[model samples]
Target: MSSLPDGVRSRTVSTDRLETHLLETGRADGDPVVFVHGNASSSRFYAELLADLPDRYRAIAPDLRGYGHSERRPIDATRGLRDFAEDIRALVAEIEIEQPALVGWSTGGGVVMRYAIEQPESVASLALLNPVSPHGYGGTRRDGTPCQPDYAGTGAGMANDDFIERLEAGDRRADSDASPRNVMRSFYLAPETELDPELEDAYVDALLNTETGDDYYPGDATASENWPGVAPGEGGTNNALSPKYLDLTGIVDIDPAVPILWIRGAEDRIISDTSFFDAGYLGKIGELPEWPGEDEYPPQPMVSQTRAVFEEYADAGGEYDELVVEGAGHSPHIEQHDEVLSALTAHLDDATTRIGNS
Candidate 1:
């Protein structure tokens, strides 16, 4: 809606000749702290987060290629995680920020981390907010469906396993048999994880009226295959789609010097292990045995989908910190802004103090 606060410049950066939406805030001379939004969300996702911070620090948020103002360089191909990383990299270079600190939410976590890996000299640090665990993200259904589509017929009919999987995997038509009432009712789950129903209703109401989400729900087949941000086929993940443009498979273990700050919502199903962000499924990643004597492999759960960031972070032995926010879900910036700010402020204070030291 409104531009990302004041003082921060708003602009577009061209990558591979394609333009992407970018919002810059804070004093022009301040150090750059770039923001990357999650899938199906734009830079606007960080509007509240931007407002939560102090003016002394400059904050930047960019819309990943397809979701927002950013143009899709290759629309027909897959928009993988690597491509998302490239977009951020190109944007940073375009803006002329020297190794800006990268901060992302959800899928943004992967992008910044990969960027840090590839351009270690260009990174100051990494901050993940309810980040997507390397293992994978949890969803509404037991099968990892984030939301239920309308084609399932009715109340109970829509929750069917086959139906939900097909929908998340992008195989079914979202609107074919969907009912508006059903779409809305299914938004909530047991114990009410969110603080505001109207907040969700507003989004649902907006989507119902939007061009893609509402009446038409034209449908995207690959929505379920792991968000547009991370490329599945990269490390032989075997995800249905590969990143359409950039190749980002070989950059994970970034410079040992870069510090990592990770925050997880205590009840965040999307990141922790709520029915939406299963911690059990995540823990299982460590259960798998690794190749004998492979130093390249960081540890078990090479790519944790949830709590494992702490695992990976601790193993790395940097100035690592993790926070467990009580009663929060996927979007900590929105759901628990005040608490998240305090945590972030504490980290930044120490980080800024140690600037250029690392």
Candidate 2:
């Protein structure tokens, strides 16, 4: 490799359905840990962090279809968090691992969030970094909104040039208006960050060889359900709180059986599955923490802020723990790699330890 550190030896586990990709290291005999990436990004986000982990962790970070190394198009048009879990299940079956720890970032958090709830057997425990969900999952978001796009109309393809142009334009506009600093809460925001290079290349390869490089999860279905009172934008606006409450409190009810460890950055902006904020969250990578004695100004909870929600969850003793990464923005793994790893290692060890004891 170039001046950048050498990444792990990875492979593509292709089933009859999809070819899963990963950046792996650690001993083969160690407990298998699967890493899931969030929306707008891929497993590539974890490259540096995984590369630096201890050798005892057999980590497998996969690019969810459409985001990373995996083929994107012709995917199940009905793809949802559960569909992602199915992929993880298939991967587990492929490796014949009895129990593997699950780790997800942002949208990937939503995936594992659903997985542990629906199929607890697959994940021994979870580590969610800067996770985004409209509902305060682990004190992330509590308004009971789901962030996704309104794929109701002409969602011809994930990579449809015209559609992509529109999407990119909207994203750029949102970024410009809300400010990249504000949107940093959504995912890793390196002043010079692009899609994971390897996964991006792999996607290009797949796009050239595959039939469809399109997104299966329609924006129409997922976007409308955002921060409780936030309405959909550019995509549409059906964001009235009452209907939103019914959709959240009644529709996709929260399950509390699964254990969660959430790492909140001092500055977190993006709320997952909830399109409450414009792509530009609070006009910064995320919201800054308001301390007790920092500003003479009185502190109040940030409106539609994910950090506030996550803190609330911790107070409720929701089977979860939260950490604040000082100086880290949206993607703590990038901002505080070592600290993030320490937190993850601790949680995973606890998970396998409990599993072994039980």
TM-score of each: 0.64, 0.64
The 10 consecutive residues of candidate 1 with the worst lDDT sum are 150-159
Local lDDT at 171 for model 2: 38
Task: Give the lDDT of residue 201 in candidate 2.
Answer: 47
Whole-model lDDT for model 1 versus the true structure?
Answer: 0.50
Candidate 2 to truth, TM: 0.64
Which candidate number maximizes lDDT? 2
lDDT of 1 by residue, 152-225 (tens): 11111112244334333533233532433233233221134443544454333322322222111122322222
lDDT of 2 by residue, 156-226 (tens): 21112442343344332233323322243333443334545554343233222212222332232333232
